[model samples]
Target: MTRTAPAPTRRPASTRGGPVRQGPGHRRAAWAAWGFLVPITAYLLAFYAYPMYRNLELSLRHYTVRSFVQGDAPFTGFANYLKVLTDATFVPALWHTVVFTVVSLAFQFTLGLGLALFFARHFPLSATLRALFLVPWLLPLIVSASTWAWMLNSDSGVINAALGAIGAGPVNWLTSPDWSLWSVTIANIWIGVPFNLVVLYSGLQAISPAVYEAAALDGATGWQRFRHVTLPLLRPVSAITLLLGLVYTLKVFDIIWIMTKGGPSGSSTTLSTWSYRLGFGNLVPAFGPGAAVGNILIAIALAFGLLYIRLQRRQDPS
Candidate 1:
């Protein structure tokens, strides 16, 4: 037929170029996504963002009990930060924090890696032993710290009694200035190892057994395989583990406070305990300086977290 076909209908330019009309299903999906997102956004704002803002405000103000309640605290700019930097406690607290974090991380990672490797063999009672090893980690921090305090007691402690049986002198673990940091550090190491073990063990389990078989067939010894294959594969997990441990160890206050109170002369006081002592451990609290110290700790953790993220990006092939 020579009759001209009817011209094809076309979408309006606005519909094509400006905005597409979403169907009911698309609208519902978008609403569902918002529904899922809104609660988390609200929660984060209420809990995390608001608290951080308040802390920052606190650090920048000269707040006393009167002013705090009245909400008339005067802003002092960076005076609080300067005061914290110049305070005599700053240097020692920073040093102690470094030592505590380093020693705990080193020992925990080493022991955890060793244990993970051992348990990877799937020996008899492996599951039982692994579960038992989680006791320190699973216990409440207060309970664990209290138990350590009692065990490390200078007088009538089981540790000292055991030392006595071995003809060794009893040492002041929690009381002495010389041993306070070390005592808390040992307790922290014990508490942290199980976490490291669980994480690293899971990482090891994700590794394919075929890789190990290939290494064995290529005449790679156990040490060689671990160094070349296992370690490389576990790099991502190890980085995250160490980063988390670093942040946690930096802010640890419960174990130190419960065990040693950062004392005999503040020898064991890290930044966290020092901050608490400033804020609430006295008759007249230095809220401004205390908040300043807390901000410093937060900054340190944030810096390390950023570094870890950057390193991860560089390591990621995609």
Candidate 2:
């Protein structure tokens, strides 16, 4: 029998030392990825990066209304920042910001955790009650602030009325310097609780039921199970929640502005309101100082964010 010549073997594309050709699908996927990236890139440039750049530039310049409009601002280096540091409002605003952030975060987290644990039992109407609790969060911030303003009115407010019914004297919620900071903090806590509840509740759900069962079988009480099992597992979620709440509280301006306009005499002024007051609340706005204050706020937030990331990396190493 005649032996047929062996059929020529085709080498694989990668083995042949030629450029490996990509399929149409690969090209399409690459194009789609680029398409997805382009809009977000443009948006960040337009909205975030550009604004930050402008704000930084503003902080470094002596820009009057004429110069601002004409784009002829004189470069002043750190003069604006120096002015802000030396300003009378700086210390008080910083202190108020700290108190507001810490107090609001404390109360909100505690109440939210309590509610989350309560609802995790999944009792009848728990979902309904949770939804109802979200009303403060669901209402527009302006509306909420306004309502608080009315309710806290010195003479004719509902809160004062309630206190009167209980035989307590009317306390100025929004008016008094001593109470103004607390008032805004309380309102902020009320608004923020639902967010915490939702997040913590979801975190609780992610804890396997078997973990709790195991703890129970080990003769752990309810408190012990929560202390050892629940709290440790919820650490990641709680950290993130607190961080977000801190950032949000640090920048809270609307509620304070609406209710107190940062004062009976600058008592409730946080950095955010102070920045706004410098930038726009006055007849002759201190644009440079305002921008400097904003930059300071940004730096604070960035520092905390970096710290959170560092702590997370230490915990997870991976």
Candidate 3:
């Protein structure tokens, strides 16, 4: 034991024969990271930031398209906002928007959730069927709206033809103010369902199979498993999709415009259509009011977006 050799002392890094060398790899990696970031930075600055600032500036100025073309406009403080807030047209339009958003969301979410759950179950041609269902979403908005408009036309349209064949009498699809919003909403629901389905299906796929197995082993049935596990797990994705759908549906202009142009008596006018009317409809263009409506929509959407970000943050604690 006494003769046992003492273990050789380990040399400190600084006491090594030569100083430790650092490769240029870290600096190169940093430069590579910035190089990759530059294009996105430039794109955001040029497209998103500048345009948003310009829109804000325009909202503050009393400028029409004519005035903009002539370059003879001045800032008008909060007069635009005041006019928008007080306008008789604006409030009803806002009400229509609210109703459309709520109604469409209700239908889309219910139908979408149902479709999502149905599609998540394994079946033949599931991928193909899912892709086919997305056709409405993939189609150009103008084209899809036009197609629906044609289908809903009072005379010789397919829907009216079908009604005639079925002895139900031809129903006014777009002409009536009462029916116009619902018709557009039907098209919107069709377009939006695929989006919700896709997102929810992906979220369902992300859930671990082990959990479902355990639930099944515990005698859980399909509905019970879905209620207890699927709904709760899909909450985050559902929240995001619902908020996005609300934001988009609130600003829907093309569907309404293409089908009815704010309708028989402006009954279907949403805030977006109202803004367009104010901007460029009649003898006197109300650019200020239009911009104000747009700004209001932006504010609402931003508020929702902030809420979404906060929820995502809470979910991701790390």
Give per-residue lDDT, candidate 3, residue 253. Answer: 83
Ranking by TM-score: 2, 1, 3
* lDDT tens readout by residue for model 1, 31-87: 787898998999999999999999999999999989988989999999999999999
Q: Model 2, 1-318: lDDT tens per residue?
A: 011111111213334344334776877777787898999999999999999999999999998988999999999999999999999999999999999999999999999999999999888888999889889988888999999989989999999999999999999888899999999988899889998898888889878999999999999999999899999998877887787677667788889999899998999999999999999999998899999999999999878867666655564443
Candidate 1 segments exceeding 4 Å error = 1-24, 310-318
lDDT of 1: 0.88
As for lDDT, the candidate ahead, 1 or 3, is 1
RMSD of each: 12.9, 12.9, 13.1
lDDT of each: 0.88, 0.87, 0.80
- Ten residues in a row with the worst lDDT in model 1? 1-10
lDDT of 3 by residue, 155-205 (tens): 968999998998988878899887888888888888778777777788778
Model 3: number of clashes?
Answer: 0
The C-alpha stretches of model 2 lying farther than 4 A from their native spots are 1-32, 309-318
Candidate 3 lDDT for residue 99: 86
Candidate 3 lDDT at 43 equals 100
Candidate 3 clashes between residue pairs 3 or more apart in a chain or in different chains: none
